[model samples]
Target chain A: MNLVANFGPGRPRVEQRRRRGQTPRAEILDAAGELFTTNGYANTSTRVVADAVGIRQASLYHHFAAKDDILDALLVETIAAPLELAERLRDVREPTPARLYALAWFDVRQLCAARWNLGALYLLPELRTERFAAFRLRRDELRGHYETLAAAVLAEAGGAGIVGAAALPFRLVEMVINMRSDEGSAPVFAERTIPEAALRVLGWPGDLDALRGRAQLLLAQLEPA
Target chain B: MNLVANFGPGRPRVEQRRRRGQTPRAEILDAAGELFTTNGYANTSTRVVADAVGIRQASLYHHFAAKDDILDALLVETIAAPLELAERLRDVREPTPARLYALAWFDVRQLCAARWNLGALYLLPELRTERFAAFRLRRDELRGHYETLAAAVLAEAGGAGIVGAAALPFRLVEMVINMRSDEGSAPVFAERTIPEAALRVLGWPGDLDALRGRAQLLLAQLEPA
Candidate 1:
């Protein structure tokens, strides 16, 4: 069943024709992402993912030892870019609203544009198990960043924030995942409309039109070229 | 496993013992709701549900022809009261914002207070199949009510609604499911914070405290005594 093989031990270059990624690992993730999001994580087997990628189950194991590993890898991929952006945005010399808007914009774009609706898998009860603790912690860290930025927005508005107010901006961004689930895809306006709504929920009395322009500039400067 | 029999045809009261619900049907739904929310719908078999309820598999089938039927029943249960409330709230002579807040308040309360986090099951990929079409339609109708009310709120503010603005209130209320999943429960502040955020996102240029008082009165008057 080997389409191509690399001459190495343990590193077995079993490139059985690229499917979605440049490597076998990527192909496995692509297949698993589809199955986990569509057929469900509990119902999809490692063998099914291997078959979808045209690789032997053992070869699939060479990259990811278990189905959980594939899921973990996919989850990490979703948050990695945004987490990095959130980290970088923290030090940028921009207004709090602009920074928050940029983070929401980047996050919503990724959630809506991903090949699979991976965020829909976030509620998989399996995630509660200890195996996914690292993923959970990383997600929490991302949420923490959102809270910090949102708190700044509330403070800038000179309004004492309501309970859970800081959390709403993050939640507003999360709505795109459910919206995508229902509508088959996110509406084109989601990228703009969601960020604006995020700021509004914080009672940001600043000019949104001005905020949007600055946020777009920050994104253009900070996003990887 | 039967503890008691109902003495009827097709309605065999094989009520071995009640776990949560009083009737055999209600008992099945309770067990299924727990299993589906915690263990996941795909992994929980009808036999497992019956075992948990101390009933025979045959008895379970007598009540629900298939597993999907049980899921459909549970999903319908989650939406039934809220949908009815939304319908009743539609004609109430309150201000548009108060009606929207009340709808969000009622919806979020149920989502948080359900015996099980049944709303978590809403994302199951199996739900996309034709078997659950009725549930999907019913849920959509509920969303339509939210959108109509939200549109009125936006229009009253004279802020021409942004694309997809009307859908945010429903999405905001829906966030409680994910919040519940993350924290293992929704916090006490969720009911008030979420609905307020829903209105804030729509730029409801009105006094929230006054609106809250009105919405609470509406709930008191309209919700069954």
Candidate 2:
């Protein structure tokens, strides 16, 4: 007998309802994320997000307690992907520092793309309370995750000898990611210029090569010479 | 003094009234800049600034017109200081690239301290509008000023050969200034770290004890044997 078949009366119905509930919840979050990124958080409203998802604002309330909750969920989902990627890289046996660093970079880039509104959120102190604690907590966790990876890379790459006095490559990555998340001006230039700058900072040999080549060179440096 | 004594009837009285009016206008900006930096642009009110200056909110309108106008005045003053400094540096006959770079760093640090809210203003798209056109224009002008300085420094340093990558140093300086303006977290570390990073990126040697020695070495490299 299947485990599903062994369920009591209404249990299957309850499970089906739960799954149904999740789809729209996820849909609302998707719409909210898009709106929050396009319009500044202060300017975005609950009604607008509901409209984007083709639902009543009251229906949105059933899923999200408030707009802040939607932002919290977005932050959680946005950061979770990169955190998981970092964890996965950490668990990989015999992973080179370069490979790990590249993974970290890609993870951050993905996070930047997914939650571009985070820049505005980070700038505003008022939005960082109560329900939004999770956003800050997850962000801190992400920073710690990247810091660990950067420390590992530095350890392998002769620790400050390669990156110079500022140990700036790490800071450069952080700055570039922050800059890319900026929606106000020249975002396209930021997106293009930052990755190239990151490659240069990593001491990758070639000038503006394919992403794979750049990653390989950077990661190879983290391996034992 | 003779011309003033021989002036038409009431000219002195009119000039005195105009000067009195200017005092409150300047006072409004000083209060606004202080309030905006300590408590963010959105959180600040013209009423609060007026109260701080011991004037009625309606009286503030007599001096400034609107809140955005006050902000525009503050931003223009904030941006103009650095450009003025750059101009002063330019007048000195062919200041060495190292001196020019150092001056730029010092000028930016001063401005960062004076205008911490400018970072928050730039990050918030809600603040950008036709009303804040002066802010945007001055911001772009500041960037152009940096680019022009970078070009001069690169040329003086004999281009990319001596500087490794001429554009990289300028980018590093920009990153340092940006990081310094971030008041939310690790500001002190960012301030200390970025200037040293800029010096290193400029290939001016990493040892703090040997800053003068390093500058000399860099100059020799720029000037050649």
Candidate 3:
């Protein structure tokens, strides 16, 4: 069960007037984010968030229209950091496939773990309602950004001829992220397993020490050539 | 929610005498399997399965102790076919990595789609219970078989030194199977995508037609000298 699945919907909603210098909205969002992460989206209720903040549920509603609104806010904040990193990596001059692959993989891993649903909610259609469309669109946009970054890098690295090879890095990264989401295993298992698997796919020497050094070398190679 | 979740310790047990001439047990299982596939495991109940077989719920209970037993039976039947196939494939003399990988990919795809709950059930903790441990153990055994097949093929192909290379084919196949389990996409998409992805990881051309011919050629290359 996901953290979101544990919280039942329906919380008391009492509006609270903000003081001249305070941001009650931010407080409500902060509480919701913690609950969603620790508990789960499904199991969390607005009342829980309000109670955590020592505010009425109505005040929480005043800050956000629904529980999904809280989720949307969390997603935007959570996903934005990695999306920014991906964007910065895309701007690197003469990017090599290996370098770009590593950057994107690392970025997605960081973002996936930070989000409570681990990005599955964005991909799951049953969860994709009109309210959640913005989150989905943002997620898709980030995906496209990563794909474009990969394509550019593959082209630079002389591996462009392989059909879907450019997109393989992104797909592999997503696969690793999904594997980490499995309840049976610890994230450490994936952390060890995925990079080795990915390095092999990228045609690197799969030795961890070699991979780390070679990844650095590949990044250096991508510098303004 | 799973059928197993609906069954608790408080439920009453009833003993029944078995009649050799009447195979009500098998009939109920057959009906339940069909209903579970079409209506989903959560939506289908013991009563529903009983109705399909023209029997009362009590008679259904006479065959299987609970709905979870029905699920366990279905899983055992579902997973056994694929394990058998893997064993048969493992016995093929002089298998190449490409041939072994392709065959494994095709076999896993077929099995993943055939058992509607196999992937989803893996996500459920109830399926990991002691009573259902056989299902998981069988799955692990099958995975070990595939890994061995891949390692043997890689060793024969003289590419064992590629650094994590020995583990690549198995990881690729596993990733593809995981993707196929996602409810959003069609099985055909994964079937096509995974093999091509596997070929690329194996350092083969990614074109599907090219892969088919190349896999055969690679197998021939691995034949005993």
Candidate 4:
């Protein structure tokens, strides 16, 4: 059911992905993601997205039947990779805190990767509508992933079972939405620090710096494929 | 210069501040804050706010010259209080961590206090307009207060100065924007825990439980007035 499995920055053969002009469908979705981020979902119509892509408005319908479908594709593009990481982390065996760090690290990386801070769109009130139900479902699945991992981390650390603790750390990972760091510092800072901050929040008793280095290494190891 | 200096929950006789229907202006602001939170700033016209208060739309202009004026009032009402607390915190001579905790604790209380979570309205795109510029400036001042305190805590604790550490904990304190815990548990949980979590993120070296109790007392001391 999860179409985004193995989809993300580390995907093999990243260069083979379509160039903007070479593939009209991918180009259209690219334009839509940009428009939705700038003008918002309600203000961005299919015609605007088509024009932005230098494609005819009529042809936009061939690739996506409706405007909401384009929005769905945008949401899926931004979210699916995080969901995939969560899906992997939720079922990980013992030493789950380390695995959770990997998930959080990967998630924080995605939040900062995009040229635009697309995660800000997550706060739009319109996303609550019935039309975005699929996106909502996937987002909830992501929440479940965070919550499952949080409960285990709290339990293992012998911390009080604070309801909604998962949310704070998950929000920390999602901090990239509002975060504005100097361009040079962002990648190193996020990779080096976010998991440490989250682990401290979780009362993780292990060496935080050591754990962060390991998480970085885990992601880096998967990078060279 | 700080219009919000005499703001927040600590001020004596908060109940004596206004009585319902005592003045049309107060009634109008209460209505506007509610309408803005529900229907959103852009969608809710002056007429709608007037109708909500059972006043003729033309009469609304008498109290506030423009719709954005009403929006400014609502923003001031919700935000002035926290800025006041931050203003107070920034000047405390010593035990700066303790002061920071007080500011954060009071802020968290304000976030959970209202019948509706007016803080969520801060995310609306309309708030970015030039109309709310003054409000935005004051909001940034409050952020500065938080950042100043965070820098002190990090420095005292000998933690590495990450580029945006101030923002993470600040956003952590602002977590009430999205938090929807069970109604009965909301106050006790937020009042009891958010400061501790934020301190943990800030790497505060002090005993957390003692600091939380102190923050509670500092706020409680102001309550009987």
Candidate 5:
């Protein structure tokens, strides 16, 4: 079965330091990230990860204490960056519509920028494992961020409390995570498209241009001063 | 790792026929479905499936030529049901709004009624295997069904053409597939909930009560008369 192909016999080869600037640790993370996305976290093994990175299995551990540590490093960049952005946007002066726009705008841009469908990792039931607990907490907090913003948009639109209202925009933006592999859309358009559709889903009847503009303004403030 | 824990070992046992009247074939399917949902399909083996059904491993082959066939059967009921309903809706006399509502209403209901999250199987990369080719075709056709309806909704909404329109509603209804286990929301409410949210996502500004009523009326004709 292709399921067990990762376990094939080998004394894994070591890398020759092919990349100019990246540390071996970073390279291991890159290779593991690709395999984890393609072969699945469950089906892939330490040996398979070593083989993919062109490193000896023993050398792989020198960088990561374990497989999950590599996964955690990825989460720090992939999942945590947006959480930081969401935290910053919560303090903005504009009302709910602008806050929701900013969140979806950058969030979709991040998803489009990722090298693989990271949502595949998010969907795995194996994520409930204790190894991923830290990542899970940040992920849940990001979810809470969306819910708070979505709730405001609903209320702003006079759309009153509704089941899954908070969840609607979150799922809409998450559609980016699940989009087809060959998707050729520009991230610029996706920034506007998803959050705007989200406003529609919230029954928001505000000016789209104004809301999108606020998101861009807010995005600028998020960068280093 | 808990990742592979689903593939347990067992000698197997015989069923007592706990239910009043399920045939052995039907019983095997029920057990396999439960295990597949509880455990990843790649992690589940013939022995584990047989033990779940209280049957000998050799006996499982009598009913299902192999494990994938059992999976194929579940797809027929869980995924194929919506496809069939969409086919029936195609022949009905209604606007695209009513047709999309009919599709989502029944689809969300069928999802809530199913005992397991079958969409998890649909997400597996292994689904691209040759055996699943037929299922993939039907699944793609269902996607086409959503895009056509979504395009009409977007045109009606005066919304600009952009990224991810067709995927928005499919992912929205598929949220039912990803909902948390503790969720006890009324399915009766979901019948209205998902479709209406989808119209909002499509930016449909039509009177919802009237549209929902028409969807319900068209739903009656979907029965195999």
Candidate 6:
């Protein structure tokens, strides 16, 4: 094991110094996420990301082969935690409304709290391309989880007959992206309001206060210590 | 008037032939709309738009001074009708819920029925710059209208103290943009469900069926012949 590995296969690679992340890859993603979100993804270039990261272009290529790979990594990072939570929530034996609320709450909080508005990337026309198919598939799976939870909530609320009601909870959580876009910040009321609104739209007849308590408890129990 | 006026300041400008619209400007907008919505705004150039319209780049300049101008025109067009309707609905004698419902229904229908998904452009980071301030202000005005109507609906529904309940209806209607983004079409349930959901999230306790009837009548009265 070499004590000092160069950043990449280039002449005189600079040491990774004072970037936000623990490693070169994290530093690159940090720069790319900022540039992509604020400067527009289509408009950002690898050179620019490298410049931002204080890395040479060849060094960036060493870590990620292309701009798409960097973007894919960032996109995947945004969804991975929530998707894991959603998957874990599936195995938890709780009321459907509480489960649904926890999912929306946790998802909205992340969307709101991320360092950059990476959720905004979901609107990129580039996402329609096959290059991002895996990211798209993962997003679909997450949406499926939200829909299943929503459907169960509707059934419990006697609204199973309401066609398309299941679709709104996922859409409601996603609305945080737009909300952040408009307000230039995490919407102040998002965590408190969106989860409740998601249930309300599904015709969940339970008191939101009680549902909030149960959902909070579920999230605490499931969250890693 | 000259019968054979040149399309622009250049030798042998081609006459406007069969395009989507009667005039060259409209035709240019039609083509740009398609290209911007399908390909993307940043990815498209005025030259590409000119080629799509089967015109010279100089002629395209005669119609739109810059690509930003074309986008500004499109952005303004998307909000103009709905803003007008929202303004007019303010004067109509109907319950607040019905008026709000009509505004949402009309907005959702336009978003869903447009020849292109221009609403998707609203998320463009370019809009954050000063160049698009007018369009942004108009959208804020539209949101303000929704919030005002929503607040009234809540007041009547006994949830007046519910902070931020008014914000969700506008956000809910805007979700149609995201739905279209994911699904690659106007979501089938958007026009029918979004308007109702907007009211439902606001704690509207009235029968949706009854509100729908009044809102429909209100729209019929306000719409131009």
lDDT of each: 0.86, 0.52, 0.54, 0.66, 0.70, 0.84
CA deviation > 4 Å runs, candidate 4: A1-22, A92-94, A160-164, A180-188, A220-225, B1-23, B160-164, B181-188, B221-225
Q: Write the per-residue lDDT of candidate 2 for residues B1-225, one digit (tens) a residue.
A: 212121322122222221112466776777786667556666778988876666657677876878888877776765576666555555555444544454445544654555344544555554445777666676666556555655655555443322233334434544543444332433544434444444433334335334534444543434211
Q: Write model 4 residue lDDT over B61-127, tens digit each, in one string.
A: 7778898888777777667877866765555464767777888878778778765566666655456
Put the candidates in lDDT order, highest first. Answer: 1, 6, 5, 4, 3, 2
TM-score pick, better of 3 and 6 = 6
Rank candidates, DockQ, best first: 1, 6, 5, 4, 2, 3
Better of 4 and 6 by TM-score: 6
**Per-prediction TM-score, please?**
0.93, 0.66, 0.60, 0.80, 0.85, 0.93
Clashing pairs in 6: none
CA displacement after TM-score superposition, residue A72 of candidate 1 (Å): 0.6
lDDT of 5 by residue, A120-176 (tens): 556555555687778778877888899888888787778533455667677677766
The residue ranges of model 2 lying beyond 4 angstroms of the native Cα positions read A1-39, A93-104, A111-118, A127-131, A152-171, A174-225, B1-40, B51-54, B94-96, B151-192, B199-225
* DockQ of predictions, in order shown: 0.74, 0.15, 0.14, 0.23, 0.35, 0.61
Candidate 6, residues B1-225, lDDT tens digits: the string is: 323345554455455463588777888899998888878888999998987777778888887889999999999888888889999999888889899999999988888877878888877889899999988999999999998999888888887223577888888887888888888875687787888888888877668888889989998989633
Instruction: Report fnat for all candidates as fractions from 0 to 1.
Output: 0.81, 0.14, 0.08, 0.20, 0.24, 0.59
Worst 10 residues of 4 chain B by lDDT: B1-10
The all-Cα superposition gives candidate 6 an RMSD in Å to the true structure of 4.2
Across A1-225, the per-residue lDDT of candidate 4 in tens digits comes to: 312222222233223333354566777878876666655556678988866765556667878889878777777777788787676555545376777788788887777776555665665555666887888888778777877787788888886434446656676776666553212124457654677667767777677767767766666644311
Candidate 2 per-residue lDDT, tens place, A1-225, comes to 212221222122121121112467776777776666556665689998876665657777877878878877766765666666556556656434444446545654654555344544555544435656666677666666655655554455453333332235434544543444432332433433444444333333333435546555654444211
* Candidate 3 lDDT over residue span A43-107, tens digit each: 56888887776666766677788887777876676567656655656665533544554564455
Q: How many backbone clashes does candidate 2 have?
A: 1
lDDT of 6 by residue, A139-171 (tens): 999999999998888888886223577889888
Candidate 6 error regions (>4 Å):
A1-18, A160-162, B1-19, B160-162
User: Which candidate has the highest lDDT of all?
Assistant: 1
Predicted structure with the largest DockQ when compared to the true one: 1
Question: In model 2, how large is the Cα lDDT of residue B52?
Answer: 69
Task: Tell how far residue A181 is off in model 6, in angstroms.
Answer: 1.1
